[model samples]
Target chain A: MRRIVVKVWEFPVRLVHWTNFLAILVLCATGAYIHWPFLSTPTTAFPYVMGWMRLAHFVAGWALLAGLLVRLYWGLVGNRYARIGTFFPYLTRQGRKSFLGVLRYYALLSPRLPPHLGHNALALTVYSGIFAVMAFQVVSGFALLGQADPSGTTYLLTGWIFSFVSNGWVRFAHYAATFVMGAFLIAHVYAMWVSDLAERDGTSGSLFSGYKYGELEEFEDFGPRPR
Target chain B: MAHDPHNPRETALEQYLESRGVDRRSFLKFCTAVTATLALPASFARKVAAAVAADDRPSVIWLHLQECTGDTESFLRASRPTAAEVILDYLSVDYHETIMAAAGHQVEEVRRHTMEQYKGKYIAVVEGGIPTKDGGVYGCIGGHSMVDVVTEVCGNAAATICVGTCSAYGGIQAAAPNPTGAVGVGELLPSIPLVNLPGCPLNAPNLTATIVHFLTFGTLPRTDSLKRPLFAYGKRIHDNCERRAHFDAGQFVERWGDPGHRQGWCLYKMGCKGPATSHNCPQVRWNDGLGWPVGQGHGCVGCSEPGFWDTMGPLYERLPNVPGFGVETTATKVGLGIMAATAAGVAVHGVAKSIQLRAVEKKEGN
Candidate 1:
C-alpha cells in the first residue's frame, strides 16, 4: 500500500496548544476559587486573586479565539490533510468507515489497521465534538462575563438567558459543566498516556516534529486514509 | 347588664348582656379596640360605640371545619381590650362550636335559629377549609357535612370572613394531591364577598379589621384576587426582614448553627423563602408582637404563601442549583482544546506512519 504524508501545522499551532493546556489548568484551579472560594484567605488578604482569575480568564479567552481563527485559516491554506474536510469525517461514507476503522484498531477488534496519512476518523469525530463544545463554552463564558459588564454583547445575550433561566439556575449550570470538563480532562490525559506508552510511534513527539513516516508506494497504490 | 333606659333601641344588646353578664365599660372598650384594630381614627371609635349601644349587636355564626383551631387561638390572644369580656360584649356570638357550651342538637338548633332569624344580616366567620372529597365525608359536625352547612349559611350571609390559611387558601391540608379536595370559601361561592386572612392562624388584627371595615363601611374593603386584604399581604417579608442588609451585601448563612447563624445573618442559603413570599408577619409579628420565625433564629418558611408546604420545604436547605457562565471554570472549553490537540496529535502520528510506509514502499519498488 502507498503512503503519503506532508507537513501541515506550523509552530504557532503547537505553541498555542501547549499554552492553552497550561492556561486551562490554571483557570480550573482559580475557577474552583471563584465558584466556592475554599480558601480561608479573606477577600482582603487576596483581594487580587479573584481579580487575577478574572483577568486570566479574559486573556485566555482572547487567546483561544485567536487560536481558533489561526486554525481555521490553516485548514484552508495548508497541505491536503490540513483541510477542514479531513477533521470532519462523518460528512462522507468512506470517511465514516475510516473513523470506525480507527475505533476497531484501538479496541483490538481488527488484525489489520487501516493505514492513514492524516487524522483517523475517530480523531476527526473527536475534533468536531471538541469544536462544538468550545463554541458552547465560549458562548456560555461570555454570557457569564457579561454579568459584570452590562454594556458588553456577551452580557446582553447571556443576560437575557440568565433572566429566562433565573440567576440561580444559570450559576448551577456553570458549576456542573465545570465538573464535567474536569472529568473529561482526567480521562483524556489517561488515554493519551496509555496510547503513547503502547504505540510509542512518536505519538506526543509528532506534535513538536510536525512530520511522520509515510509509504511512497502506498500513496500511489491506495489513496490517503486516516491512521 | 342593665339597659341604658334612655336609648330604648339598645334593649337587644342589654338583654343579651344581662343574660351573659358582660359589664358596660368593657363592652365600650372592646368597640374602641376594634376601631383601633381597623386602623380607624379615634373619631370612628364613637361610631363603633354607637353601633354597640344600638339595640342590634350584629349576630355572628363562627364555624370551625377542617382546621387546627389556630384562628381561635389568635382571636383569644387578641391583646386589645386586655379582658375576655370585651370581645364577648361587642358581638352577639350566637353560635360558635368550639367555645359555646351547647352540645350537638342544641348548637345545631342555635345555628339554624340564628340563620333563620338574622339570615341575610348576620356575619359568617368561617375558620377552616371545607373538604368536598367523597361528598364531604372527610369532616362533619352534628352528622351534617361542614361543607353543606357552610354552603347553606355562606350563600345567604351578608359577608363572610375566612379567618385563617385553612379557610382562606385551603392551607396545608390542600397540599399536593389534596385527597380531601379542600377549598376556600370564595372558591365554593363566587357571588359572596369573602375576605381571606391567610396566615397559619391569621393575624388577629386582620380579622378584627375586616370585621370593623364591614361594620363601619357596610361592605368588606377591596381585597386581592386571593381575597387577602391588600393592606396586610402586599409586601414580601424579605423586603422588611431585619437581616436584609446582610443579603444585600451578599453575606449568607452557609449552614444552620454556623457563626453567621449566631450573628443573625441572611438565611437565603438556608432556604428562607421570604424573598418570594409576601406577608406582613415580619412587621406585625406573632405572640402579641413579641417575635416571628426570623426573629427567633429560624428562617421564614413562607407559611402564609400558597403551596408553601411543597414550594418552601425542606425548610433549612439551600435553593436549588442554577447554571451560570464560568468566569473561572472552563472544563468544556479546555476539554475541547485538549481533544483538538489530541486530534492534531493523531494526525501527526498518522502522517509519520505514512512516511515510514512510503519509504518501505519505495524500497520495494526499487
Candidate 2:
C-alpha cells in the first residue's frame, strides 16, 4: 500500500473549529448556571456569582458568533475542502453515494468504505446542521439579551423578534439548542474516532495537524470510486 | 352629573380648586409631584401647572369594555387621592361609564354629545378589551358593541389611552382559547395614536401622570414601540427592584416560607417575571407608594407587559413553558432528557461499534 500525506484543513479552518468548540463549552456551562443558579454564594461576601456567569456567557456568545461569521466567510473563499459546498456534499451524486456508504459503514453493514481525506459526506452535512443551530442560538440569544433593556438600541435591533415570539420562547429555544449541540458534539466525536480507527491514518489528529495519511489508491476521493 | 349646556360648570381648574378651598401652594406642590411623575425637571412644575390650569381643558371619555373594572377601581381608590386626584378634575373627564350618574339612554347621549363636540380632540381612556368574534356580541354598552364604540369614539379622538392589560393586550380574555375573541383598543384603532398602559390593574399614578404629560406638553410623552410612556416603562422592574442586591448576591427564596423567603432574598427562583417585565412598579409602586408586589414579598405577575397572561405565566414559575403548545413541559426538562438520551445512545453505540471492530479484526486475522 503506497501511503501519502496531504494538508487538508487550513489553519483558519482549524482555528474556527477550536474556537467554536471552546465557545460552545463555555456557553453551555455558564448558560446552565445562568438559567438556574446552582451555587448559592453569601449575599454580602460574594455578590457577583450570577453576574460573572452572565458576563462569561455573554462573552462566549459573542465569541461563538464571531467564529461562526468567520467560518461563513471562509466557506465563500477557502480551499475546496473548506468551501461551503463541502458542507452540503449530498448535493453531488458521488457525495450522496458516499453519504449512504458512510451510513452503511456506521450501521456495520459495510466493511470497505469510500475513501475521503476530508470529512465524509455524512459528517459534513451534520456539521452544516450544527452551524444552522448555532446561528439560531445566536439570534435567539440576542433577542433575549435585548429583552434586558427594552428601550435601548439593542432592543430596537433585536426586538423585532417579539413581533414573532415572546421572550420566554426565545430563551427556551436558546437553552434547548445547547443540548442539541451537545448531542451533535457526542455523535461527532464518536464518528471521528471511528473514522480514525478504521483508516489508521491520523484522521482524528488531522483536526489539529491538518494533515491526513492515506493510500495512493484511496486518493481517488470521489473521482470515480474503483473501476 | 350630566353636561348641562345652559348651566355649564365651566369653572377653570384653579377656580375649582379655590372654590374647594385648595391652597395655591399645595396645588403647586401637586403640580411638582406630577412633574416628577412625568420625569420632567422640577422647574417645569409651573409650566405644567399653567398648562393644566388653562381655560380650554381636554375632555376625557373613559370607556369600559369587556373588563373587570379593576383599572377603574385602582384609579378611584388610589392610596393618596388628595393631591394627586386634583389632576383628575383638571382633565375635565366628560364621560366615565362607571362613575357618571347618568345611565342608560341619557349617558349614551352624553357620550355621543361629548364625542361630537370634541370631534378630533378628546382623550379616550379605554379600560377593557373589545370582543371581535361574532360581530363583537361578546361585550356591549347600551346596545352598542365595544368594537363599534371604540371604532367610533376613539376613531375621532385625539388619542386613546388603554388603561389596563385588557384594553391594551386583551388581558385574560385574550389568553389561549380566547372565547370572546377579545382584542385591545389599539387593534381596533390601529390608525390612531394610542398610549397603552397595560397592567392587571395599572398603577393609578401612571394613568394620571400620562394625562398630565399630554395636557402639559401638548403631545404625549415619548413612548416605546408598544406605545407605553417611556417615563414609566423605560426600565425593567428587576433593574430597580429593591431586592436586586439579593439577586446579584445569588440569594434567592428556594421555596415559599423558607429561610430565604423570610430573609427577603430575591424571588427570582420563585418565578418572578421582573427580569423580563418592563414597568416602574418598583419605583412608583401601588397603594399610595406604600408597597408593591415584590415589596410585599410576592413575585411580580408581569401584569404591565403586553401579554402577561400567555407570555409571562405560569405566574409562580421562573420560566415559561413551551409557548403556543399549552403544556407544563419545561425547556430544562426536555433539554436534559434529550442530552441524557443522546449520552445513553452514544454509550450503546460506542460499545456496539467497539465490539464490531474487534469482530472485524478477528475476521481479518482469520
Candidate 3:
C-alpha cells in the first residue's frame, strides 16, 4: 500500500537481463545436445539435429557477448547507481560492510538488512563473477567450434586454449559449468518469485515494464532521475 | 651375448648374421626398420647392425599356453620371403610348440631339454594367459597345469615376452567375471623382466622388432607402462588414423550406406574405439601389410587393447544414446554422463524449491 519513488535497474539493464536469460536457456539446451546427443530418437536426422544445435549455440553466444558489451558501456556512461562502482562492491568500506551485512542477513544471523540505492554489494559481487565465468565459456566454446574452420580468426587466437585444456578436460569444464549456471538459475528464479511475493505491488514489473510501485526506502534506486 | 671388448672392428652381430648367410643389404634393411620402430637416431642403425653381428644369437623358447594358436598361425602365414620364418629362424628358435616338427613326448622333452641347456640365457615367449582358477583346470598340456608350466619355465629365463592380448592382458578369456581367472605372465610371476605385445592375434612385425632390439642391444628394449614396446604402442590409433582428418572436419558415418558412410568418413559413429586403443594397425596394417579392418569398410573394434571384447563391444553399433544435433553427431561417453547428471540435478532442485515454498507459507501462516 506504498508507492516507491526510486529507480532500480534502468531500461538497458532490464533488456539485458531478459535477453540473456532466454539466450542462456537456449544455449544450454542446445549445448547439452551437442555434448551428448540422445539416440532414442529413431529418425535418420543426425545432420538436422547437429546444425540447429550449433546455430542456436553460436547465436546465443553472440547475443550474450553483445549484451555484455552494452552493459560494459553503461558501466562507464550510466548514472552513479548504474556505473561500475555499483557493480564493484569492495571500492569503499561502507560498500564492504553492506556486502557482508547482506550475506549475514541471508545466513539469518543479522536482525537488520543492508540498504543501498543499487545492487546490494553482495548481489553486485555475484553478478560480476557470473559475467566473468560466462566470458570464459564463450572463449572456450568458440575455440572448439573454430577448429572446423581452418581460416577462422577465433580459432587462430583461441586454438591454443583448446590445445591447452585438452579436448577431454575442456568438455568436462563446459559440462560442469552448466550445473553451476543451472543452480544460479534456480536460486535466481526463487529469489525473484519470493521478492515479488513479499512486495506484491509492481515489484516484478520492472523486468517486463521497467517500472515498479513501492515505498521510497523499500528498494535501491539503480539509475539516474530527472531533477 | 656380451659385447666383445677384444675385437672392435669384427663386431659380434655382423659375424653372427654372416654365419647365417644374411647379405649386408638385407641386414642393413632390417637394422633400419629396427631404428624406425624404436624411434632411435638414424646413426643407431650402424651400431644396431654391429651389435647384432657381434652378439651371440640369444636363445628363445616360444611356449604355447591355453590359446587358439591364432598368433602362431598369423606369424606362419607371413607371405613370400616369409619374414616371419626368416625372423624366427634368425633368432634361433631353441624351442616352439606349433612350428617345430617334433611333437608329443619329443616335443615335451625338447622344451625341458632346451630350458636346462640355455637356462638363464634364453627369452621365454609366452603366447597365452595362465588360467589359475579351478586348479588351472581350463587348459593343460602334457598333463601339467599352464600356471605350473609357466612358473617352472619363466622362473630361470632371462626375460619373458607375452606376445598376444591373451598373454599380455588376458584378452577375451579375462572378460567380465573372468570364469577362468586367467592372468598374464607378468601378473603370475612379477620378478622376471616382462614385455607385452598386445593384439587379438599379435602383430608379427611388433614381435620381430622386439626380438631384433634384444638381439641388437644385448638387453630388453624400453617399454611403456603396459610392458608394450614404446616404438609400437606409444601412440593412440586415433592420433595416426587416416580417417582423423574427417573427424576434425566433423564428418562421420552415421549409417551403413549414408553419404558420409559412402565417402569413407570417420567411423567414430559406428562404435570405432580407435580413439582409446593404441597400436600400429592404422599404419602397418595386417596380413603381411595388406589391409586391416578399417580398410575393409568396417570400423576398428579396438582388438589390441586390454579387455576390449567386453568394454568396447556392441561391435557394429555406435555409442549408445549419443545426442546428435546434426548430420554426423556422435556422442562421447563424457557427454552422456554429464547430461544425465544435469537432468538429475534439475529434477532435485525443482523438488527442493517446491518444498521450500510450502515451508515458507507454513511459517507465514503460523
Candidate 4:
C-alpha cells in the first residue's frame, strides 16, 4: 500500500462550504437577537438595535440561500464524488448495506468502519436532510420577510405559503430549524474529528484543501476515487 | 320596507339628518375621516359625502349566527356621537335579528320580502361563523342550519360583508378541535364577493368605511387575498405601532407588572401579536375612540387574521405553542435542550474516541 492524495471536494464546493458556515454563524447570532433581543436601551431612545439585528439576519439569510443555490448547481455538474447522487446513499441495496455499516460503526458496535474518498454513506444522507431543512428555512424565511410589505414583489412570490400553514407556525419552524441544524453540526464536526483521528486520514482537512490522503493499490493512484 | 331608489317621497340622508339635528359641517368631517381611513385623497371626502347623502342608502340585512352579539352591542352601545349617528343612519339596516322591532317569524318574513325586493342589490352583513359539521347541526334558526341560512341569504345578495372575526375567518368557535366545525362566511359563500372586517369585534368605523366605499365607488374596495380591505389590513400593526420606538430600542415588558410594563415598554415579550397582526387599531380604536387594548397596556391578541384563535395561540406567550411539544414547551426551551444534549453527546463521543485511539495505538505498538 502507498499513500497518495486525491482531490475530492471541488473549489466551488469548498467555497460554498465555508460561505455557508460563516453565513449560518452570522444568521444564528443575528436571528437569535431578532427573535429575542438581548440588547436594551431607554424606551424614549431609538438606538435601532432590533432594526440592525433584523438587517444582519436578513443579509446572512440571503447569503446562506445563495450558497445553497451554488452548492445545488455544483451537485448537478460537479465531480463523481460531488454529484447529487452521492447525497442519496440508501437508494440502492448496496448503498443501504454501506449505510448500515457506517451506522453500526458510529454506534461503536464494531471497531471496523467503511471508508470513502468523499463523504461516506451516512454523512451524505445526513447532509441531504440538512439541505432539505435549509431549503425550508429559506422558503419560510422569505415568506416571513415578504409579510413586512404585503404589496411588494416579495409577497407576490411568497405570500401563498400562508395558505398552507398558519403564519405563526412558519416563524416557529424557522427558529426551530436553526437549533436542528445546530445539533446536526455538533455531531457532524465530532464525527469528522473522530474519523480523522481513527483513520489517520485528512478527513477534517479535506473540506479546506479539497484533497484526501489514502493508500489504494500496488501503484500510487490519485484518480477520482476507489470504487 | 317601502324603499324605492327614485322615490320622490324618499328622504335624502342630508335632509333627514338636518331635519333631525345633525349639521352639514359635522357630517362632512365624518366623510373626511371615512375617506382618510379608506386611504382616499383629501378630495375624495366630497365624493364620500355625496355618496352618503345621495337619495336612498343601500339596505343592509344583518344576519346573526353563532355569535355573542358583541359586535352589535359594541356598534349600538357606543357614545353615539354625530359621526357615529351619520354612519348608523346611513346604513339603512333593514333586518338586524338582534335589534329589529319585528319578532322572529315576522322578521324572517321581512327578510324574505327584502331578498325578493332587492335581489342582487342588498348588502348582506353576516356577523358570526356558520356550523358545517354533522350537516350543520350545531347552530340553527327556525329549524334551518346556519350554513343553509347564510347560503340562502348571501346567495342572492349583491355583496356580503363579514363583520367580525367569527364571520370573517371562523373566530373563537373555529379554534383548535372545533366542536361544531364552524366556518367563516367567505368559506360558506365562495362565489359571493365579500369584504372581511375581522377583529375580536371589528372596529365599527372600519365596517362603516367599507360600506361608504361600496356606496361611493359603486364597487367593493380593493381587498387583500383574505378579502380584507387593503386600507385597513395593508400595513401591519407593528409598522404603525406606538410602541415601535420601544421595540427598536429593545425595551420589552419582560413580564406582567414589571418595571418595563409600568413604564409602558414594548409588549412584544408579552406575546403582542401586533407585530404579526394587520389593523388600524392603534389609529381607529375600539369603544368610540377610547383606549384600545395596547393603549391600556394589554398585548394584541391578533384578532383580525384568519383563524387567529388557532394560529396565534398561547396568546399570553410570545410564540404560538410549538406543535407536538405539548402546550408548555417553547422553541427556546426545546432548542436549549437539543443543544445541551448535542454537547453531551459530543463530549461522550470525544471521550470514547480517545479511549478507542489509545487501545488501537497500544495494540499497534505490540
DockQ computed for model 2 against the true two-chain complex using alpha carbons: 0.60
Specify the CAPRI tier of model 3: incorrect
Best first by TM-score, ranked = 2, 4, 3, 1
lDDT of 4 at B38: 92
Please report, as a residue range, the 10-residue window in candidate 4 chain A with the lowest summed lDDT.
A218-227
Off by over 4 Å in 2: A222-227, B1-11, B19-22, B41-43, B90-92, B322-328
Give the per-residue lDDT of model 1 (tens digit) for B313-342.
Answer: 556543342225333434345545665675
lDDT of 4 by residue, A1-227 (tens): 76877778889999999999998999899888878877777644667778778888889888999999999899899998878998998998867887998988777765545656677789899899999998898888988888879999888888888889877788888888999999998988888888887776688888888888777751132245443
Error of 3 at B179 (Å): 1.7
Compared with the true structure, the alpha-carbon lDDT of candidate 1 equals: 0.66
lDDT of the structure predicted as candidate 2: 0.82
User: What is each candidate's DockQ, to 2 decimals?
Assistant: 0.06, 0.60, 0.06, 0.59
In terms of lDDT, the poorest run of 10 residues in model 4 chain B is: B1-10
Return the lDDT, model 2, position A37.
89
Single out the weakest 10-residue window by summed lDDT for candidate 1 chain B.
B318-327
Candidate 3 matches the true fold with a TM-score of: 0.62
The native-contact fraction of candidate 1 is: 0.03
> Which stretches in model 3 have alpha-carbon errors above 4 Å?
A1-227, B1-23, B82-84, B316-366
lDDT of 3 by residue, B1-366 (tens): 333446567654455545555556777887787677777899998887666565466688888886888888777775654433465765655678776777787778888987898889888899987888999999898999998899988897888888898888887788889999998888888778888998888877788778778877767788755678877886677768888766545567788988877777778767776755668887767787787777667788877776676656556654422234542333434445555575676566555555665666687784
i-RMS, each model, one decimal: 9.0, 1.8, 8.2, 1.8
- TM-scores of all predicted structures: 0.53, 0.93, 0.62, 0.92
Give the number of the best model, judged by TM-score: 2
Q: Could you tell me the TM-score of chain B in model 1? A: 0.75
